[model samples]
Target: MKEVYINRISKYLPNHPISNDEMEGKLGIINGRASKGRRIVLRNNQIKTRYYAIDDHGNITHNNAQLTKEAIVGLCDDDFKAEDIELLSCGTSSPDQILPSHAAMVHGFLKNGNIEINSPSGACCSGMNALKYGYLAVKAGQTKNAVCTGSERTSSWMMADTFEEELQYLQTLEDNPILAFNKDFLRWMLSDGAGAFLLESEPKGHLPLKIEWMEGYSYAHEVEACMYAGGDKLEDGFLKPWSEYPSDQWSKKSLFAMKQDVKLLGENILVKGVDSLKMALDKNNLKPEDIDYYLPHISSYYFKESLYKEMIAQGVEIPWENWFMNLSKVGNVGAGSIYIMLEELVHSGKLKKGDKILLSVPESARFAYAYALLTVC
Candidate 1:
């Protein structure tokens, strides 16, 4: 098998960063009322700013596909042309439409002529899947190069209009936002952005990241859904498909609203993630000291200590100095989070040759996780 290297990395954060105080103003308050959980959630999450693909009044400026196209364009320059891309793999938890796979829509916007494309849809692991697919293709010598993109355009779903219909039934909330804690908490957490990576059989650009290995695991069969959208949860912890609901009930029930069982997430997300991490480390014969930088796609800063403690319990503690995160700066972009982190570190002038970077992403939706090890060269 041939070696695969990430030749270039690019990111596109839409518009300007929205400050914490400006969140509800931009997303709009639900039914002209502010959320009671807003301050508490922001305090715990410790997010200062995040980007949204919308204006102050919540009008969409760029859809998911357009955000992805802009990121891919950033990977092209004098040495590479958009038309010359061989494979384009796009991954996203939030897409612009229901029909036509995400990659197809992105390619349509790119107008990069004909090219092979694939779209891997999941929560946080979608981007890892896209990257692994491209990595394997290049490693197998089936393709000389591939362009992989991860993006999220979830700001549209977080808007007040998306949940206005549900507010009609909120009699208990006299002056506060009407959304349930499950649905409303996500509004302050998610942001819009895209990240792209170029993979090739040989290294290019300064400090190309060599793909050492990729590992992934799913506990969906053993675990119930914890984070979800476009559906409602049943009494037995199963999700009722959005297709089964009447069209009129969609907005009324907020079927498409991004939601989370916060209690369930707190109980299982950390333990499951550490379990997957232990497996990957054992399989690869790696130890904590081997990782020079640890980039974790975490939703909140509150989890920083919890994750470290959980890893210690699992006997895989990487030191505090090894951890690198930008959640406070960029917010959570779901599947796009890991790609954005990787892109930032690739050009931060922090990694030296022989440095090892460990990446971990956990998706609470169905409990899927992915891990990868990269060596700076």
Candidate 2:
């Protein structure tokens, strides 16, 4: 019954621009492979480019908290005061410290704002999850204003020899050639970046987007499918071990897990995305033709395309051309992708008042999140 709106949004990338060609050069030399055989070159072609935080030594920087702070500062106008901020939530995988969440680090950076902050570790869904929490907080009258941020500095966790070791590990699995190639492809897709947004309960003058409703669906799948633990070892980064689970037992076990946790997440995401749009239409009772834009999670190139296809198959009319695709350029900024895209649309004047936008995010662990925002001029 309560309304939540996104008053402002902003995004930031590191100064270092790591192009595919540069990555290819590094890969070719490291794997002792010909330029043609190196998969990074090929996969990089599918993606636009990604930003990386680099240290003075030119190594990838892993300061997600710093990035989140920088992004928030950039989003806030000079007139905005930190004291006005009631909540600060960060959705991120890379924390400044293992014990202290990134939210604490971000809170310390604020000069005038004494706000309650929370750092969430929802893996890839963190950004969206944080946004949902902020929306609920405002809707429940617990806060008048809030900020949700999603940032990652995975490169900081990566070592120069890391790729080499992974490549070598794949070479050892010569018997599973397809699996090797898949692993190689993923290596190229991994990137580092951060994005953030500012949310207010009530619009001051005019705003581009207003949050109508949000819902989350989480399916607890096999722990090994996607697992990450912080440690000194390089292998502790993102791991997709779906193959490790037994095939015959996977679907059943995964389905069972989904029924209990993971499936509900996916179902919630799908239901929210579809139902929110339907509710908007039903309230006004407008046809599908009346809606204007849609922004789904830019997870991966293949994943994005597959999701669109699935939506279409489910009878959801989506504007394929209007869909903003940025993962190729920015890599996957985890929970930040949808909000970052939302900001881009507003700044670019593509999203207009009265237009309906559907936000969808389907992640690993059988998690799904969906929300609807109507531009209120």
Candidate 3:
């Protein structure tokens, strides 16, 4: 089989970096009962700042397609032509519209003639799925090169018009506001960013990462409706009528209609995520010692201890120091986290000519998980 290499990677982050202090005012939790909850969330997540595609006054500055285009264009130069791209793959948890996939919208922005496009839409793991699709295509000789992109503008979904109502509901709940106001808490955790990777069957320059092995898993039954957006689920597990929701809650526009079971996410992601990682390593014939760098796209710092403990309990002895996390700076970028982290690691001057990297992404929506192995060369 032909080998595939990520020739280059690039990212585009919005200018507004919202700090924890600023988040208090921005989310209107100041002096409210939710204030303490917000502080606890900030302390637990350990995210100092997160970028958002919004202005100083807190209005959306760019749509998802525009953010994705910025990332795609950042990957190109005089030596690369947008028209020459053979395949374009985009992944996202939020999109500007439902009918036209984010991939199709980005294609319109590129105006890069006609090329095959695949948009893997789902939870965070979809980003890995997008890259895996392109990697498989290149390795199978279907295309020589491809552009894989993961872009998100989560702030738009977070800044809902019904926030005051949500807060009112939270104030009445007996549970911790941090847990009761899951969506509101997420507003502080997720931000806006875009990342793109250019992959080819042949290496283009120094420091290209060769794809070794990749695998993906979905435990839908185990995590039913844990984290979800759009149409509500009925008691019988059937989808409720879309019309039942406020018209504004539809995916056609910026809406904060997600219903998340935060408790469910906290219960499942760590254990199942480690299990998925072990399965990937086993199938790829790799051991914990084989990976020199570990890039884990976890949602926050709260999971770090649990993850390490489980790895040890399961006999995977990868050191805690071997892991790298960027949630402190970028927050939970959802699908774009791994790509951004990989790009940052590439520029951080950490690895040498040849090193093994293990990438893992766990998505709470139906608990999709993905893992990949790469060799830096």
RMSD of each: 1.5, 7.5, 3.4
Find the candidate with the highest TM-score and give its number: 1
lDDT of 3 by residue, 19-119 (tens): 98877555455224444457777888899999888888866778988998999898888899888899999999988988788899999999999899999
Candidate 1: which stretches are off by over 4 Å?
171-177
lDDT of 2 by residue, 1-377 (tens): 46787777778787766676666443234455433434543453366676667644565444777788788887667677666778998887557676677888888776645688877676667887788788888888888878888877665444334445444455676633221332343345556666776777667644546877665555444222332322111244333343554664333222111111222333344444454445444555555555577677744464455555555665656767757656666766666677677777777766556777766665553343444556555
Quick one: ranking by TM-score, best first?
1, 3, 2
Tens digits of per-residue lDDT, candidate 1, 95-149, equal 8888899999999999989888999988889999999999998899888899998
Q: Order the candidates by lDDT, highest first — what do you get?
A: 1, 3, 2
Candidate 3 ranges beyond 4 A from true positions: 27-36, 164-179, 233-256
- Number of clashes found in candidate 2: 12
**Which of 1 and 3 is the better model by TM-score?**
1
**Against the unseen true structure, what C-alpha lDDT does each candidate score?**
0.91, 0.60, 0.82
Give the lDDT of residue 187 in candidate 2. Answer: 42
Query: The CA-based lDDT of model 3 is what?
Result: 0.82
Best by the lDDT measure: 1
